[model samples]
Target: MSKAEKTKQHIIEKTATLFNTKGYISTSLSDITQATGLTKGSIYGNFENKDEVAIEVYKYNAGLLGKTLSRSFSDEYPKALDKLHAFVDFYRKNWKFVFSNGGCPIMNAATEADDSFPALKNQVKKSFELWMSKISTAILEGQKKGEIDKRVNAEQYASLFIMLIEGGILLSKTMGDQSFLNHALDKITHMIDHELNILPS
Candidate 1:
């Protein structure tokens, strides 16, 4: 990367947590300058405005979540059933990684960027779809490999799984209790053991 590219990335990385914790509406250019330690001209030189920075920050935060999923799929034995369990296990292991960084970016942005930020709203929507696709792909592989039941609908299960997870995170963050998220993941694990698994539990 060129010097300018590196500088822009430095700004994005520095202010990512601030954007995640503080909504785009509440976060100002001054906040970016404070977090990044960059002058106003430097900030504006890299980004057209706070809105542009927010969009990149959203992508940066979302990439963290993608990494969580990526690691979840990296197993010695990557069966479909195991992958499903890993989905739960990922959040189980990364609760602090997520909660400390101001909760799930898609969830945070989706709730905050409704009528005002169309571009951000679209970004969140695409992220949701991408996450759901990942789940569905795992389910399909499990079904084909005889690890998961063929009768279960992959897309339907994917949506349900995400709904439970996101709801759990929302509650956990709001109540300052990890149990809510843990309980949701526990429920998914149970569903995998009984409803989805073709292997004996």
Candidate 2:
């Protein structure tokens, strides 16, 4: 990448970690400058303001989550159901990272920006819709392949799954018990396996 692009990326990366740790409003322009080792003028040369840097940081954090989910889905699992399980398993295993880095970006953005920033609130909403769509698509594909029950509602299940996972993550972070996340995942996987099965007793 060019020098400008590299500097921009460096700023984004550093600021993302800070935002995740200190939050948007809590983190100031001076904080960004300190973390990036850049002066106020240099920081402004790369970003318009704290809001601009925050937006980029949010995108960067969300991209990290997206990459994790994508890798889980792309693993060498033989069945779509297995791939879906892997998706949940990945989150369960990485609950520490999720919570430590200021919890899920979607959750953080939803709570922090919903009442303050319209643009950021919209971004969070879009991110959730995209995630739900992906899970729904996978469930539909599994059903079509005879790996899941045709009677099941992919969209509804997807929504429920996301809600449960996000809620579980929130509670785990709040309670300071990572096991809460694992337990939630276990229950979610059980429900999916049972609800989406076609085999008869």
The model with the greatest TM-score is: 1
Model 2 alpha-carbon miss at residue 84, Å: 1.1
The digit string of per-residue lDDT tens for model 1 on 141-187 reads: 88888888999999999999999999999999999999999999999
In model 2, the clashing pairs are none
Q: State how far residue 128 of model 1 sits from its true place (Å).
A: 0.9
Residues 1-201 of candidate 2 have per-residue lDDT tens digits of: 999999999999888878977876678998998999999999889888888888888888888898778765564775768778888888967877777778898888778887787777887888898888878888888888899899989899888888888888888888988777777798778876778766632
What is the RMSD, in Å, between candidate 2 and the native fold over all Cα?
Answer: 1.6
Candidate 1 structure lDDT: 0.89
Model 2 per-residue lDDT at 188: 79
Kindly give the number of clashing pairs for every candidate: 0, 0
